[model samples]
Target: MTAEILQKVASEGLPPTRMNARRLFGSFSFSHQPPYSRLPNELLSEIFLYATCRGVDDRHEIISTPIAVSQVSTRWRNVAISTGALWGTIIITFPISRGQISRALTWLKRSRSYPLSIFLDFRDPSWDWDLPESAHPFRWQDMEALIRLLIVHAHRWKQFELLTDTWAPIFTILHYSRRIKCAPILESISLSRCNAFFAARNATFAPAEMKVPIALFGGLLLDCLREVSLTGVHVDWTTSPLRNLTTLEFKYLATDVTPTKDQFADILEACPNLHSLTIIGRGPQADSPPSSSGSTATNRPDSRSKKSARHVELMSLTSFTFGFNDMDYALEILSMFSFPSIKTLALENLSNVDPPALQSLDATPLLKRLSFLDVSSDATTTPFPLSHIISLKLYSISASQATFSQFFDKLRNLEYLGLYNASKDVLEALKPSSNVDFNSSILPCATLKDLECRDMDPETLLKMVKLREAVSHLGHVSFEFSNLCPTLRTNFLDAGIDVVVQTTAQ
Candidate 1:
């Protein structure tokens, strides 16, 4: 039977699921076969819907989800063809040839009245040149025509994601999608063009010549929109459909092209129900570029001209990630919001900022329920006022023994701690004190039950975990190591500690 199964797989390929074992077994059957076709149309249709959405995540993973199900058998085909929602999640790559449009339309038609989720990737084209005899460049016209087809069904779009390396396809989409008056049920939209690195490295390659912010989706009514993520894509924040967002991310924008501080303030005011927010690269820019006058900020470090920021209270936001390349730009946005209900906070100073670069981040006034903190900073002392943080992740951080002890002293309730590229002094501070009466903060806090470290010294790790285990503080430990001793893992396992070891590339 095993030989038969292998032989069949070696010859006739199976469906993506490869679940039809009874049929594959051929002649080795039970007294009665289960009535798979006895399932009601509605139940079968629901199964088909599940099959399509859960297919492959890439084309190597994404291609065979629905189509493979439909081609299984006549009964399966009929059932799948009757289910419109099964075809609603459309994934297409651009530069569509002449024949691909008909196929795309078939899927669109089969989708019927169901909501659509479109993922269009026009990244690296397979080929832009077809014929050597004549000038047959990549079918920009055909691609635009395909987008036009998609635009015609824009009313059904529930989720749309368009990503490209160049900006030309985005322009094409924006131009054609203007006809959409309202995506009445569009829930999430992501439009990204990752050409910022090129723009920064080579000043000559400017997309749309760095055009002014434009109204996205032809100023359509996005009453049902919930999540929006834009990277290297300019949109008029003041007039765009940015309100009522549960998740909002704007990244990889230039200072000149970002929303102005006033506009961003209005955006925050409008998004009262926002839950998760991320702003990286240059955020809302000040009226004047901070670097125009050869200064870090408009207000000098000595002048203390920190104007009262237009504060907005985020009562619902639980996860907030903000990284900045410019000090004034970072402060300009940080001083504006108070994340009173924030649970997960990630602060990243992308640049080598000066001492008072994050002075505007007075977390005491903003945060009240922060339980998870991930910070990428090179500071001697901890920045945020964290009282309830149970999980803490530090990246690219180094602190002295005194400072490390002071920092750990504050995280008395910290149970799970992760360190990546942390300095040696930070580790040395974790050495347990011999004095049993010594305060936990004076030593490594014994409250820690879980530890995760990346690219750290194995010797230091073993000693630290062993000492902490002696105090019965540690129950679980996860490590990412290039080379580790075999007995060390065995020893920890024997000690009944939950050990998770991940091997990194040499």
Candidate 2:
């Protein structure tokens, strides 16, 4: 019988026998698959939801999560397709093709009744072209199509973000969207303009020439809207919905146009529950037309300013940021609000303002984080009474050692200190004198734990670190410099301080 079998194997080619053996092995492997594959469908669906729900801003992940998970096996494919929440976020980019629209429609169908988070990015890279006068680079058709499709689901919009290079598309969408009276579940709306640098550099390019208004959503009100961000886009404060907002940001406003003081105050008054506010003014464009004198009249304090003294108290506001090219303008806006609960304050570009503005800032004792960018001692004289401040950051601030020492003296509870573009005098003040006793020195921030400095003198920094270590306060020190001596780093490590050195590019 063995001889007969061997003869049969020899008669038939070895490939046929080998194919059968491989098939048998594959069947065995499939039957005894990994333990995870044996997980119940319900648990697997939950895992899929968790994985797809995170990192919402990652466009690639958002598009690939459902497809990749479903491709694993027939069972997973069914489970993934059945999970409606996995397809809730739909990001539509500009230059939209038919295929992309189809995919978006499919996602909408799969998402079912889940509230949608729609991000419409109309910042076409082609718009970056420095073309001649006869050419216009915009995909108006594509933009209109995408906006129309999204408007159909207006009631389901949870978050709507429109990013465009020009204001035309934004206005167009808002104009058509006014028909939808209420977005019952809408929570956040962010409308921003791209090509800001281009617009800033080109004085001849006028956004107003396009005949689009700055403010949008005139007659429509989103009762559920909690966050609104507008960048380089104006809004009619009186007509725009500004209630129930928790976060509001306005950046790079038009130079020729701005909300009047009263209008701004009224908007804040309407949002009694606001918690965060950021406003950055647009600086003058080079060689551009000068703004009319009346442009900033509302922000200026005249004899009639007594009528504008009614302040809006923001009791729930905890974070506030104000940046402007004009010191008076910044002060004017600041004078409108009294934030008693503010814990974080950032002042930018108003470096040469009067000391009175710094003194005018309310909630000094409650301030835990303070940042001064491009500030000068000429502008800031009155030291802030920030006894509870734990983190302080200063950037491009030219101040005398006495001024820095005076400010540091106020931060008795400071733990983290960061200095960038610091002047030599500022660095010298931070260097503790070797002759002075650490325990008895009048230096401030006795509770200092972390120190970060850029473009600083290593020797001076080392002295400061030693001083802090002597007082048993130093924990970690990071420096950004062109080069550092290896021995210096080893010395810090020997002192039980975690030292991080980032080499700067030449």
Q: Write the per-residue lDDT of candidate 2 for residues 416-496, one digit (tens) a residue.
A: 777665565656666555565756345556677787777666667767677666655566777776566789777756665
lDDT of 1 by residue, 170-212 (tens): 6667667677876899999999876544212112224445365
Q: List the candidates' TM-scores in order.
A: 0.73, 0.73
Q: What is the lDDT of residue 167 in candidate 2?
A: 62
Total clashing residue pairs per candidate?
Answer: 3, 2
RMSD of each: 12.5, 9.9
lDDT of each: 0.63, 0.64
